[model samples]
Target: MITWLTIIGMGVITYAIRLAPIVLLERFALSPALRQALKFVPVAVLSAIILPELIMPGGGVDVSLANGRLLAGLLAIFVAWRTKNVLWTIVVGMVALWLL
Candidate 1:
């Protein structure tokens, strides 16, 4: 009983935590510059999260051609740039990683 109650309480708390930001921000009108900057936030955040893993698969920096992840990531970037297709980029990256 206590475990279930704790889980329910945590679910409510998590929902409130996520909902509060949207509720509060809805009242304010963001500036054009801020809105434009927000467009890049996802990309920046993703890069910050993903770059380390690709560059340091073994917990140490490795930028050499021997690093499969780094190589695959580069190929993925190229595919994304040229094709502008997320699906192709992911498929190519995964295949490149497997081959490497």
Candidate 2:
């Protein structure tokens, strides 16, 4: 009973924490510069999350050919740059990783 209650309480708290931003931000208008900068937020966040795993798969930096993730990430980067297609990039990256 206590575990279930704790989980329910955590759910409510998490919901409120996420909802607070939307509720509070709705009242104000953001500046044009700030809005434009917000466009890069997703890219920055994604890079932050993905670059570490690709560059350092085993808790240490690995930039050589032995690193499958690094090679796959490089291929994905090239695909994204050349084709600008998310689907192709993902497919190629996954296939490369599996092969490597």
Candidate 3:
């Protein structure tokens, strides 16, 4: 249970983190090579964090084929690949999970 002040403090901290990059990077101009490399940094970092959650969310890191979340996530990925729409992917994943 988060208190109001705690939530507000988290919001303030998050705000500061969000603003920090703009404030710090405003005066700098990145070179083309560096800019291209930097563009992938966020995706790499986000994938580093999200991949485990998608496939091995149980914290035990048990990647057995019997895992329901892994199956559901694969179904979601297939749906996303076929439809190229998040709404459809979510709907299909929900249906798969509900029926499982």
Candidate 4:
């Protein structure tokens, strides 16, 4: 019961925190420069989360050829760059990882 209550409380707090930003932003218009900068936020955040996992899949930095994740990520990057298709990138990356 205590754990459930704690989880519910945390969920409410997290929801409120995220909701406040959208509510406040809706009331005011952002600058052009700020809007442009915001477009890169998702990419930056994803890179921050994914790059480390790919480079260090075992919780330790491993940039050698033996690291399947690192190799797959590099191949994914190449696919994304060449094809510019998200679906293809994901498919190729997963297949590369599985085969490796």
Per-residue lDDT over 1-100 for candidate 2, one digit per residue giving the tens place of the 0 to 100 score: 9999999999999898678768888755678998899999999999999999999999999999999999999999999999999999999999999999
lDDT of 3 at 27: 58
- Can you give the lDDT of residue 80 in candidate 4? 98
Clashes of 2: 0
**Which TM-score value belongs to model 4?**
0.71
Residue 39's lDDT within candidate 2 is 97
Each prediction's TM-score versus the true structure: 0.70, 0.70, 0.64, 0.71
Model 3 lDDT, residue 81, Cα: 88
Q: Between the candidate structures 1 and 3, which one is better when assessed by TM-score?
A: 1
* Candidate 1 Cα errors over 4 Å, as ranges: 1-26
Report residue 30 deviation for candidate 2 (angstroms).
Answer: 0.9
TM-score of 2: 0.70
Tens-place lDDT per residue, model 1, 33-89, is: 988999999999999988998999999999999999999999999999999999999
lDDT of each: 0.94, 0.94, 0.81, 0.94
Clashing pairs in 2: none
RMSD (Å) per prediction: 4.5, 4.2, 3.5, 3.5
Q: Which candidate's TM-score is highest? A: 4
Alpha carbon deviation, residue 79, candidate 3 (Å): 1.5
